[model samples]
Target chain A: MLVNRVKELRAKYNLTQGELAKKIGVTRQTIVSLEKGSYTPSLLLAMNIAEVFNEPIEKIFIKREEEE
Target chain B: MRLYITVILRTLLYISLAIMVYDFVRIEQQFELLGRGYIDSFSVNVGNQVGQVFIVITIILVIMNVFQLFVMKRNKRAKVEDYILPEYDASDERSVEITGKAVRFAFVFILLYSFLILGSYMFVPNYFLDFVWYPMFTTASIPIIGLIVYLISFKIIYSR
Candidate 1:
C-alpha cells in the first residue's frame, strides 16, 4: 500500500486541505483522496505536494509492506 | 460556469440529435402512409413539432455561445471558442483519470449493449413495414445509452 504524511504535514504547516491543494496545483478532492489513501498521485503531483510541504517525496509518501 | 455550460450544451446536442432521428422516422412513416393511399394529404404536424423544437434548441445554443463569446471577448481572450464544444472533466489530473475510467466502462457497456441490440433484431423479423421507427430509435439509442452510462460511471467514480 502507498502511505502519505500529507495530512500530518499539512497540519504541522497550519495549512488547510484547500490551501495545500492550491499550492500543489491539484483539486481539493485530489488532496482528500490522497489523504484517504484511496488514490495514488502521479509523480508530478507527488513532487508538487512534496514541494508544498518542503519535504522530499520519499519523506512525504511511503511504500508500506503490509495491507490494512 | 464552464462545466455547467458544457453540460447544458451536451444535453441540448443529444436532444437535438434524438429529435432529428425521430423526425426522420416520422417523415418516412408519413411517406409510407401516403404510398399506401391511407391519407389524402400530409398531416400539418408532419414537420412542425420537430422543426420548432429544433429551432428552439438552435436558438438556445446560439444564445449561450454568443453570451460566452461576448464575455470572453471583453477580456480579450481567444479561448472562448473552447467553451462551445462539450468536453470531459479535465480540471485536473484526477478528474482526467476518473474520466478515463468512466470512458472505458462506457465503452464496454456500449459493446455489450450493441451486441444485445443487434441480436434483438432477430425477434422482429418483419419490422420495416409495421415498426420502422423501432430500428431508427434503437440505433440512435446506442450513443444515448452510452453517454448516460458514461455520465453515471463518472459520477460514481468521482464521488468515490
Candidate 2:
C-alpha cells in the first residue's frame, strides 16, 4: 500500500482538493482517491503532485507493508 | 471563449441526442402506422431509411462531441490555474481502469445470460420463434445490457 501526506500537506498549504488537483493537471477525484489511499498514482502523477506541493516525492508518498 | 466552446459542444451533443430520440420515435410510429394499415409498405421503408440516416448523423455528432470534449480537457489541464475548470478527463487512468473492469464483468454476465436465453429457446422454441426479429433484438440488446452493467458497476466502485 502507498501511504501519502497529501491531505496533510494540502491542509498546511490551505489548498482544497480541487485546487491541488488543478495545479497538478489532475481531477479533484484523483486527489481524493490519493488522499483516501484507494488509488495508487503513476510515478509521473506522484512527481507532479510533489511539485504542486513544493516537496519531494518521497516526502509525500511512502510504501507501507501489506497487512495480513 | 474556451468556456463558450465547451458549452456549444455540450449543446450540440444534447441536440444530436434529441434528434436521435426523435428519429427513433418517428420510426416506431411509422411501424405502428404500417401495422394498422394507415401507411403503405413503401412509406414505411422510406421512413426507416430516413431514420437510419438520422442515426448515422447522430453517431457522427456524438463522436465529434467526444473528440471536442477530450480536446477541451487537455486544454484545461495545460492551463491549470487558481480557478477550477468545469472540464473532466473522462479517459483518465482510474476511470479507464474502472471502465475496463466494468466491461469485463458485463461481458461475463452477458455470456451467462445468453446461454440461459439460448437454453430457454430449446424448450419454448415456438414462443421465442414467434417473433421473426427475436435474434436481432437479442443481439442488439447485448451492448445495451453491457452499458447498463457498466454504469451500475462504475457507480458502485466509484462510491467507495
Candidate 3:
C-alpha cells in the first residue's frame, strides 16, 4: 500500500489541492488520486512534490504498515 | 494509442501505393524499350533492378511503421499502468519474442525465395524469371508478412 503526504503537506503549506497540482505540473485529479492512494507518482514527479514540501520524500510519503 | 497506430499504418499504405504507381509507369517504359528492338535481355535486367529496389524500399517503410506502432503503444500503456499498478513491472518478454519471430520469418522467406530461384536455374531452363516477379511477389507477400508481424507484435505488446 502507498501513503501519500499530499493532504498533510498541502495543509502544512496552507495550499489547496489545485494549487499543489499546479506547482507540480499535474492535473488536480492526479493530486486527488495520489492523496486517495489510488495512484503513484513517477520518480520525477515524487521528487518534484518532495521539493515543494521542503522535506525529504520519506517524510511526506511513507509506505503503509501492510506494505512493510 | 490505437488511434496513433492506425494513422501510422494508413500513412505507410499511402506511401506503398505511390511507389507501386511509380513502378508501374517505369515498367511501361521498359516495355516500350523492348518494342523498339533492344537486346532481348535488356528490359528483363532493367525491370528486375527497378522492381527489386522498389520492393525493398516498401518493405523498409513497412518495418519502420511497425516499430512506430510498438513505441506508441508502449508509451501509452506505461503511462496508464503507472497510474493504476505501480508495483508490477510490465513484462517485455513477449515483445522480445515477437521481434525474434519477425526476424526469423524474414530470413526463412528470403531463403525460400533464393532456393526457388536457384532451382529454376537448374531444372527449368526454358522458364525465364522476369522483372515483374519481384514486385508481384513483394506486393502479394507484404500482406502476408504484415499480418504475421502484426500478430506477433500484437501478442507481445498486449499479452501482458
Candidate 4:
C-alpha cells in the first residue's frame, strides 16, 4: 500500500483542500480522497503534490506492506 | 460563455429526456387502450409514429449533449500540464475511480437481479409474460436502478 503525508503537508502549507486542488489543477474531492487513503494517486500527481509542498517525493509518500 | 453553453445544453438534454418519457408513456397508454378495444388501429399507428419521432430526436440530442460535455471537460483540463494528468482519459483520477467502483457495483447488482428473475421464471413460466407492460417496466427500471445503486455506492465510498 502507498501511504502519504498529504494532509500533514497541506496543513504545513496552510492550504485548504480547495486551494491545493486548484493549484494542482484537480478537484477538491481528489485531495480529500488522497488524505483519506481511499485513492492512490499517480506518480505525476505525487510529484505535483511534492512540488507544491517543496518536499521530496519519498518524504511525502511511503510504500508499506499491506496489513492482513 | 462556456458555463452558459453547458447550462443550455443540460437544460435541453433534460427536456429531451422528458419528452421521450412522455412519448413512451403515451404510447404505452395507447397500447393498453387498444388491447381493451377502445382505440382504433389508425390512432395506434399515429401514436407510434409520434413516439418514433420523439425517440429519434431525443437520441440525437443526447449524443450531442454528451459530446458537448466531453469537450467542456477537456477544455477545462487543457490548462493543466499534459504530463501531470492521470492515466485514464477523463478529467481526474478520483472521479474515474469512483465511477469504476460504482459501475462495478451496479453491474453486479444487475447481474444478481437478472439471475433472480430467471430463477423465478423457471418456477412460474407465465408470471412475467402475463402482464404486457411488465417487460417494458423491467427494462426501464434497469437503468434507473443502476443509476440509484451507483449514486448510493459512490456516496458511501467517497464519504469515507
* Docking quality level of the chain pair in candidate 2: acceptable
For model 1, residues B1-160, the per-residue Cα lDDT tens digits are 4545555555665666676777777777788888999877786354566557667767776776677556546543234433333345555678778877988998999999999999999999888767766786687777777777878887788777
Ten-residue segment with the worst summed lDDT in candidate 3 chain A?
A24-33
Best by the TM-score measure: 1
Tens digits of per-residue lDDT, candidate 2, B1-160, equal: 3333443444444444444555555567667778999778744323455446546655664565566555655654332221122222243556545655766787888888787767765665665224434444455455556555655676566555
What TM-score does model 2 achieve against the real structure?
0.65
Which pairs in model 4 have colliding backbones?
A: none
| Docking quality level of the chain pair in candidate 1 | medium
Candidate 3: where is the Cα deviation over 4 Å? A7-18, A26-39, A42-44, A65-68, B1-160
| Tens digit of per-residue lDDT, candidate 3, span A1-68 | 67887898799899999898888766575676678776666777788899999899888778787734
**Worst 10 contiguous positions by lDDT, candidate 4 chain B:** B80-89
| Interface RMSD, in order shown | 0.7, 1.7, 10.9, 1.8
- Please state the Cα-based DockQ of model 2 relative to the true two-chain complex: 0.45
Candidate 2 Cα errors over 4 Å, as ranges: B1-91, B127-129
User: Lowest-lDDT window of 10 residues in candidate 1 chain B?
Assistant: B76-85
TM-score of chain B of 2: 0.50
B1-160: candidate 4 lDDT, tens digit per residue: 3323333443443444555565566577767778999767635333355446556655665665566555646655443332122211234666656657777997898888777665655665564335444444455555555555766676677666
Clashing pairs in 1: none
Candidate 4 positional error at A68, Å: 5.4
Better candidate by DockQ, 1 or 3:
1
Off by over 4 Å in 1: A66-68, B1-12, B32-44, B47-49, B55-85
